[model samples]
Target: MTCSIFFSTELPNDRPQVSGALPRAPQRWTMEWCVKTPDGRTHINNSRTIQRATVAEVNAIMATTINGIKAEIGDLATFISGRLTSHGGTRKNRKGGKRR
Candidate 1:
């Protein structure tokens, strides 16, 4: 099984809305996936998530889940690197110029 994905969110209703158009802490995540083997295997998948958050919850996913996925797809170096940066990464853009 091979999977690739991206996830992030920034909401104006910063306080944390439990429901409705005005959400309190609405979040979002999207994933694209496929499973395959030349011999006898193939699969496909996708998903999204919008919900609340605690600092710890996000951190745990960053620390644990991200690393776990990298290890799982350890053979795919270039693909994993770009996928992690583009999707699973958490780098805030800086004001002045370059990398943050």
Candidate 2:
């Protein structure tokens, strides 16, 4: 049983979608902090220095994300319903590359 066999989910092959959150608060460093070396590799710290989060706490935080998105538009239900086929994730910092 290899990784490719164990954790493979398929999506429809199509053009990628682009999206942006209009009125969103800046994402900042919370309990989950990571360090990215200059070489472009990302490291998630899992040490005593970090406080552990409970499942409930994490879910609560994630719920706020939807609230933030709704607040960004005049009518979230309408906006989302209209762009059901489009709206993707945040596009900021999309220049995913090693800046040497």
Candidate 3:
């Protein structure tokens, strides 16, 4: 399994500012994660937009997300391995033939 994390900033579009009013804040930042298989095919892709966040906050969020992904992958691997072992690492065809 492979994974990637990306961080980016988003700027607001050019527009006339109103007089005597606080300026609009930029969209701020976006964080994205992509999980891929060993074959280089994408398995999961997700993103979140953050506003007015500090670097520390971003890092915390990223770490948590990564840990969650790791746990999920581990659980899936365990389940698959258990199933394979239960079947003696062999599969049966419709014609009662054993398949590896």
Candidate 4:
């Protein structure tokens, strides 16, 4: 099975007003997932809305995600390099001479 994930921000269209009352907390971010099966069917799922998230909270989440992606890239580079080294440290021409 293969899955795709998405993240989005939502804002209220309008806020209700009342006499001498504070407004409701804002609804901020949401995480959604779309899953697909070989049978050509898709399923969508959503996480509960995140309300009133602070700047630091959002920053931390971004930093963590970036770090995770960087780690994955490094691992992939290592794997590819290892594969190349195992096959032969360098490529050769069809005439069996090193291509420089």
Candidate 5:
């Protein structure tokens, strides 16, 4: 599994547009992501864009994403540790018995 973070200033056609529509405020920022797997599976977040987002606003987004990733990693590590410990410890010999 791989992950990445990216930033872009351009908004896609789906974004609201009108003859007199004012440009997005400086604080407004757009964010999105798409993923395709080898098996022709795809995933995307269509409504993740931020409105009237400022530098601080964007920073907050980044911080929250980073924190979430960190928490998931920590949880996975703990799960792995628990699984290993429960299965006759990490080092085992044949017949599912602990090794000397």
Candidate 6:
């Protein structure tokens, strides 16, 4: 399943009615993300929220999350590259020509 994450500038008006853990620590704002699967169904059946005191902190968290995702994609690319090259396979360019 392919999944993507995005930060919304506006809160969803028709959010699903679900309760989550309240922020226990000192925090002024909460950032939320909804994970949806194919057919437009929520993956977790609920929105995930994280509490942070400042927008910078939330942005930092988002950056870290994005970086982690990039790392995972890199690993997957490496694995696929190894597999493709394992059986004497050659890399192909967009024009279907062998890549140097």
- lDDT winner between candidates 2 and 6: 6
Residue 4 shift from truth in candidate 3, angstroms: 14
lDDT of each residue in 21-92, candidate 3, tens digit only: 221332233455555545555554445544554434655766677568768776332111000000011234
- By lDDT, the better pick of 1 and 2 is 1
Clashing pairs in 3: none
How do the residues 11-63 of candidate 5 rate in per-residue lDDT, one tens digit apiece? 35423222222233333334444433345554444334344544345556655
lDDT of each: 0.36, 0.29, 0.39, 0.32, 0.36, 0.33
lDDT of 2 by residue, 35-87 (tens): 33445554442211133343334335534543444464322232121111111
Report the lDDT tens digits of candidate 1 across residue range 36-84: 4334444344443344433335434444544565477553423221111
The window of 10 residues in a row where model 2 has the poorest summed lDDT is: 1-10
**TM-score, each model?**
0.28, 0.26, 0.40, 0.28, 0.31, 0.29
Top-TM-score structure, candidate number: 3
Candidate 5: where are CA atoms >4 Å away?
1-25, 32-47, 75-100
**Which regions of candidate 4 fall more than 4 Å away from where they truly are?**
1-27, 30-51, 75-100
Q: Indicate the worst ten consecutive residues by lDDT in candidate 1.
A: 77-86
Cα error of candidate 3 at position 93, Å = 74
At residue 35, what lDDT does model 1 achieve? 37
Better of 1 and 6 by lDDT: 1
lDDT of 2 at 63: 40
State in Å the error of residue 60, model 2.
0.6
